[model samples]
Target: MTDIEARFWSKVDKSGDCWLWTAATTYGYGRFAITKRQMIGAHRFAWETVNGPVPDGMVIDHLCRIRLCVNPAHMEVVTNGENVLRGEGLSALNARKTHCKNGHEFTPENTIVTKNPSGNGRACRECRRAAWTARATCPECGGSFSARNLARHRTNQHGGSHV
Candidate 1:
């Protein structure tokens, strides 16, 4: 083993299925300082030590769901979306929700999905239309409509020509 690997292994408490990091940590996961000015997640450091560089746009997930685990055997590489889905935490629970919090069924017609800071999440299309209807006013026609309706309204009023 190399010197870096030795230092990393020294901090591991391998008495359990999940090899726990027994060193300084932030947010339950371990933190390793490579130099006076550099730091990286200990779990990540441990992974690269044995496997290799994690591919860009991919994240390493703790299959065991133990944030402190550094065992490469318990890790898997996946996209951010996949990682969130596989998690057993709050995000996973929310992602699995069949309806929005306000009881709107997340059908294809009523669900708006987009990337959020924490990967991807769905919004209620009905709520979006409602909000737009309540707040948006067309500048061209001084007409009241949701943004979606306003698009059609403009098209109908303007003889179906691009505005």
Candidate 2:
């Protein structure tokens, strides 16, 4: 075996289904030095060593969910977005929601997708309209107005004091 391969295998504990790396790690992922100034994920190295280069626009995902696992059998290549969706992060959790917090089903008609600096987010149209309606009722005059009209109503009718 080559020097690098031997060095890599020497650090792995293969007693179980997931081959765990027993070396340096960062953020729960095993790290390996491939060159004097370069490091790579140990799992990635293990995968490439056995299966070949990861496909373009694809990343390695650990099916075993163990970041330190270097077993190529426990990994799969997938798109970055697919990887995130399969994870347990906020984005994945939010994407898995079939209904809003107010028990409104996320039907196409009841859902409003909003684009922001972070990313696209889903909002319930009924909940949003309800919130707007609640704010649209003028407290001073007890008058009902549209959301846009409420500010003008408060200004013109209430002399801008309530606004």
Candidate 3:
């Protein structure tokens, strides 16, 4: 192995946590501490030693199940979304709740599909109707449009127009 690789491997603790060389600088910052700096250094060392370089749009995950441990052997590269799903712990996995914020379960009878640039998604029609029933004035001009047409009346009648 090269000198840099050799130097990196020499800093691992018995627990597999990587450490930074006292002489090494991070992002031009100063020496590595045993705690915070060591964790960051370990991640960097693991990436550099095994992967050579970390490409953009990729994240290193701790497969060894230790966030502080930085053994290159324990690290794996994955997408950010996958990392989040993996890190969400057990609660998300066990969660069976799919209701809207207003307790509207996403059933075909109560859900409506709206087409947006992002694609079609389910919306609770009951919530929309309830929200519509609670409004009094046009949000744009303060002219009365009732709860039903408040949003549309604002855009079509009062939008970009004074009074």
Tell me each candidate's TM-score: 0.62, 0.87, 0.44
Q: Candidate 3's error at 82, in angstroms?
A: 3.3
lDDT of 1 by residue, 1-163 (tens): 8787788899999999999999999988899888768898999998998899999999999989999999999999899989977877788888789988789999999998889786777899998877776645666779787666777777788666544
Off by over 4 Å in 2: 133-137, 146-152, 159-163
Which candidate, 2 or 3, would have the higher lDDT against the true structure?
A: 2
- Clash number for each model: 0, 0, 0
lDDT, model 2: 0.93
| Residue-level lDDT tens digits of model 3 in 57-152 | 988777655555556666788887677556655533423347877888878788887878854456788998887677576655667655766656
Q: How many Å off is the CA of 12 in candidate 3?
A: 2.2
TM-score comparison, 1 vs 3, better candidate: 1
* lDDT ranking, high to low: 2, 1, 3
Evaluated with TM-score, which candidate comes out highest? 2
Judged by lDDT relative to the true structure, which candidate is superior, 1 or 2?
2
lDDT, candidate 3, residue 33? Answer: 41
Pairs that collide in candidate 3 are none
Model 3's lDDT to the true fold?
0.62
Stretches off by above 4 angstroms in model 1 are: 88-91, 99-105, 109-163
lDDT of 2 at 41: 96
Winner by TM-score between candidate 3 and candidate 2: 2
